[model samples]
Target chain A: DQQVKQNSPSLSVQEGRISILNCDYTNSMFDYFLWYKKYPAEGPTFLISISSIKDKNEDGRFTVFLNKSAKHLSLHIVPSQPGDSAVYFCAASRYNAGNNRKLIWGLGTSLAVNP
Target chain B: GAGVSQSPSNKVTEKGKDVELRCDPISGHTALYWYRQSLGQGLEFLIYFQGNSAPDKSGLPSDRFSAERTGGSVSTLTIQRTQQEDSAVYLCASRPPGGGTDEQFFGPGTRLTVL
Candidate 1:
């Protein structure tokens, strides 16, 4: 079962514009969500994250908003730059005991920033 | 290196053969995880290790797959009797000692081709 889903396979945005990516999940067990950016031939790099307790979290140009009731979350990048073009993956995981947190990843959305 | 690293960036093997992939997590990171990403698919959790003990091996697709960590550090994922369907990029991630709330650092990954 695909607990986390990113419906958009690809997205395009021009430089110096706002770029948004959305993710949805069915499992209410998910309480922590993270966004990762990946480039070809490389592993994913952590971008931003949010806890179910908080509605929003921001780091520099990136921000993540979570809606527990709606089972949705979004990653926003303001003034998107060419360097931001990459595949973005949304992952969700819940805390249990013994430090067991296995992240469930989305199919990933390819973002292209036009110059 | 300062970041997580995987060996033999690419591997190709014939069917019915066994292959082993390695992962070296970031120094002082106590949590390790293994994930798989097939072509056009999202990342799939395979297993997780906290220190030298793996509390969750539930994600392993089949009995043919297994993983182990040694000395509270490096990990290895072994797949027995490889099949064509097993071709995918195997990624490893590491989290600090705290918990799932921490963002994970991922390695470049090993692309395994089963022919």
Candidate 2:
């Protein structure tokens, strides 16, 4: 079963526009969420993250908003640049009984920021 | 100063052969994880390790797959008697001490092709 889902397989947006990517989770026990961006043939890089306790977290041009009740979260990149074109993955993790964190990943969304 | 590193960026082998993938996590990071990505399976968790504790092998697909971490730093994943279906990109990631809050740094991944 896929606990985390990124329904959109691909997204296209013009440069300097707003790009929003969405993700949903089925496990309420997941208390932390993160976003990663990946380029072709490269590993994913950490982007932004948010805790379930907070509704939103922002860093520079990127922002993550979480809605606990809806079991959904989204990453917003404002004034998107062509450099932002990459596959985006939304991940969720929970501290297991042993105190180690285990991550559950989504299928990933490929975002294309056109210049 | 370095992020997670993985070796053998690409590997091609015949079916029935064995393959070993290696990962070197960042210095001072205590957590490590392995994931597999394939066209048919998307992305799935394989295993995880934290310091000197026992690894979480619940995500391993079968007995043929196994992993080991030495000195709580480097890790290696071994796949025995590989089949055509064993082809995929193996990704390694690492996190710091704080569970559920730290971001995971990922390696470029090793793409394995079993012919």
Candidate 3:
């Protein structure tokens, strides 16, 4: 019953390199996808998001690419910094007329950036 | 300028005791959600509330788990007769009005330890 899945449990990348985090979902009804980064003992911080209408969305150094046909999406952090090291979670949900906007989240990927 | 806040950041209780967790969403946000995260596990959706509409309790695990949003702002989640397996960090998140597709701002989470 796990709809969203993040296959990689941990990832290590060098500073200034590109760090890619991937997520897959089986629920095609989900039209919106989001990524959140979390540090130890802290709430998750918003990262990037993509709507199914488009294939990619970018803000600053982060970009989210979505492939609807494949039911896959990824967050890419270019020139990753040590500050970028954290657990990344992918969540998907559909928006209806009312308050049924429950989110389905992935297991999360722990990314470690080596300086 | 403030973010979502939850009370009793850390709580330790004996098994069979009931525990109530609280969440205060952003001032203008109209959507609120509750999630649970266990060790090495993903965020599990628990419930959702939007404005003055009926709260979505479909994700609630059992009758022992319940939540209420008074005045469409603050929310309280109650777990009755908690079991050892109920130990986990409960997270609360909120989204501003007309921002269903946007990222949710999460609280630091309330960690519950059942002995």
Candidate 4:
């Protein structure tokens, strides 16, 4: 069974608008969540992350909100640019004794920012 | 400096043949990971290696899939008796030695096609 899930397969937003991507997890143990962006033919680049202790974290135009009670998280990008178009993946992991916990990933949501 | 890199950016092989994919992580990074993304699927963890420790091979799909990290810097993933179902993009990532909560740096994946 998938421990992490991204319910949307794709999203489209006009440039200068806001874009939101949602993810959910079944594992309550997951305390660290991250978002990654991937362009075609390139590796994924880390975009942002949030710890379970914080309900929200923001960087520039990007903000990540964590709802621990709902086991859900969302990434918001304001003033989305065409360059922001890419596949977004949500990952979650918990701190462990090994300190090398493997991240559980969600099927990515492809976002298109149309200029 | 240099980010993670993978060799044989694309490979096409016949079923039942064996293949080896390579990864060169960033200098001084002590953690390496191998993952695969099948069509329309999330990034599936295959294995992980940390400094001088036994690898975490829990995510490997079958006995046919194996990986080894040498000198804790370079890694090789071997798939024996390849099946058409094994076709996917193989991704490699590395993390610096610190609290394992840091983001991982990834390499452009190797696209494998088993005919």
**Candidate that scores best on TM-score:** 4
> Model 3, B1-115: lDDT tens per residue?
8999999999999999999999999998998999999998889889988888888888899999999999889999999999999999999999988755767999999999999
True contacts kept of each: 0.83, 0.71, 0.77, 0.83
Cα RMSD to the true fold for all candidates:
1.5, 1.2, 1.3, 1.0
Candidate 2: Cα lDDT at B70: 91
Q: Report how far off residue B43 is in candidate 1 (Å).
A: 0.4
Which residue pairs in model 2 clash with each other? Answer: none
lDDT of each: 0.92, 0.92, 0.92, 0.94
DockQ winner among the candidates?
Answer: 4
Off by over 4 Å in 4: none
**Cα lDDT for residue A38, candidate 3:** 92
Per-residue lDDT of model 4, residues B1-115, tens digit only: 7789999899999999999999999999998999999988779999999899888998999999999998888999999999999999999999889875668999999999999
Per-residue lDDT of model 1, residues B1-115, tens digit only:
6999998799999999999999999999988989999998888888888875645888899999998888888899999999999999999999998654669899999999999
Q: Report the C-alpha lDDT of model 1 over A1-115, residue by residue, as the tens digit.
A: 7899999999999999999999999999988999999998899999999999999999999999999999999999998999999999999988667657778889999999999
In terms of TM-score, how similar is model 3 to the real structure?
A: 0.96
| DockQ of every candidate | 0.80, 0.74, 0.78, 0.81
Q: Give the TM-score of candidate 2.
A: 0.97
lDDT of 3 at A101: 64
Q: What is the TM-score of each candidate against the true structure?
A: 0.94, 0.97, 0.96, 0.97
Model 4 lDDT at residue A95: 77
Report, for candidate 1, the interface RMSD: 1.0
Candidate 4 fnat reads 0.83
Cα lDDT tens digits, model 2, B5-40, are 998999999999999999999998899999999963
Q: Is the docking of candidate 4 incorrect, acceptable, medium or high quality?
A: high
Error of 4 at A80 (Å): 0.7
